[model samples]
Target: MGERIKLPNDPHSPEFWVAVRQAQGIVGPVATDTISALIDAYEAAWPGLPRKLADSTKEKYRQSLRVVREAWGNLQAESLRPSHVQALIETLGATKPGTANNVLDALRAMCRWACGPREFLSRDPTQGVTHFEQGEGHKPWTPEQLAFASDNLTGMLRRAYVLGRYTGQRISDLVRLGWTDIDDGGFNLRQKKTGARPWCPIFSELEVEMSTWEKRPGPFLLQETGKPFTTNGLWKKLDKVREDHPQLAGAVWHGLRANAVIRLRQDGYTSMQISDAVGMSIPMVERYSRYADRKAGGQAILLSMKERKQDKTVKR
Candidate 1:
């Protein structure tokens, strides 16, 4: 050969070699030994996955696998060790324990796939690795934070916030909300994540806010262009709004779900009632109602003390 083809500067880029192979008219699957190739093969056989992965879940996997591919794409799949997986998790856990756990989950799923009928890898690297401990999940918005958001956000963003707070729905479900869903004094929806059919009654505050809005033919929340928002589209818009308003930074959309549960609990709704209203399980309802429970307990104790003191004075 007069001259050898030069490899790309980034030696670990699986895409570069793939392009080269295509250019040379080589039409076949990549060598299965490398991690990158094995990952590709595993994804190609996605339907064979143990459980059906949702679109949102697949998006998370894609994000985690990008890091994995960058770090060990060119290495042999069999070379991945538990130590390597553990080290990666630890490094990622320093800043984002939740993300680290998600990454570990992705790795475990991929490795398990490879070790099964696929046989892309001889062993699982993530076998002994574990996820980082996570905290109490999303932080519910304080009343002050909620007031600030309500006063500041306008138009579609305001509508989005009102829907999230009052309806207690996820951003995914929120994007799909429309006038059609409104019936019998509530919004009836089959939750996308859990498939629970919840009928969230129109709260007085929500009704007052909605009464002023111009009725639309599409979804309740729309872009400035009058188009209904995709889930990612709404998230990006809300993120931009949050960035501009630092006071609203602590208030996340998912946290609104917790806020809704707490509000119902504070209003004296039972756990079963709250669960029915929010389309959440009883355990989740109890978890979110903890703050409300403490407040209610304190109020009850104080009321009992006042009654006892009044009786003592009467007897005196």
Candidate 2:
């Protein structure tokens, strides 16, 4: 019989491995593969996101995922059920419905990814959760508020405020506006969300404002550094104005778009015309024009129906 191979003093020592290498090869122990946590789903999902999401969208998704982890750290993905998700959204809805809906939407996307080729989880808990009403967070800015901004805002912010109020375009779209976008026709917008080419009339108001400023080399909305601002950067810039003028509370940059639609409606424009001008769907135009409709109808009623002594003129 062949002699047994010589062995090291300590069987588990590095010398033992060395000896094994001299004779028969031995593979080292492998670290165990990690089990995925709730957060892992997000990490995995991001890479596989089919469309290239905007930075704002990516941040929002990351934020929502962080929220889930904070609420339920290392929670088994499969343990999340429809009832659990619904209760979570209900709690968030009490404070910020828009935010709650955003979180829910992000989670739903995660769930779909999990159910897809990746299979991070078995089912989506968010499916049955009813979303809170959006648009309740803020309303259109009033004329007084616009006047306040005009008086208070200075430099780039003043121009930004004017563009938002008049163009009916999102800050994302407006900040990217350049000399190239301007034509003899008007302010041409390739909307970010809809990808629709919309034209805003060169109102005498915006025209006068633009005439005062020298055009920068690139985007019209240039910062002190001669660089175009990201949407968030523009938002932060405008938000600073709020610190000085509290009257602008609830009258954020986005609300300016709504205000434009509302003002157009108030000027006796039909919903269809408003829709065409603003590049909005018919449904959206109707929704925005409701106040205008009621206001006009009430005034018409006052002329026809005699004002009863009991009735005071209803303010719209």
Task: Give me the displacement of residue 312 in model 1, in angstroms.
Answer: 8.9
lDDT of candidates 1 onward, in order: 0.82, 0.72
Which whole-number lDDT from 0 to 100 does residue 135 have in model 2?
65
Clashing pairs in 2: none
List, residue by residue over 138-197, the lDDT tens digit for candidate 1.
878988889998888888888888999998899999999888899899999888775788
Per-residue lDDT of candidate 2, residues 1-316 (tens digit): 5557886664323355455445554456411111124344355445546654565677887787777767765466677788878888889899988879888887887677667665556666778787787563336788789788888788888878888888778888888877677868577777776566777776788888888978656777877887788888888887777776788876777788788888888887887777767777777767766666788899988866666533555532
Least well predicted 10-residue stretch by lDDT in candidate 2? 29-38
* lDDT at 164, model 2: 83
Instruction: Name the 10 consecutive residues with the lowest summed lDDT in model 1.
Output: 7-16
Report the Cα lDDT for residue 245, model 2.
75
TM-score on alpha carbons, each prediction: 0.67, 0.66
Residue 152 in model 1: lDDT: 86
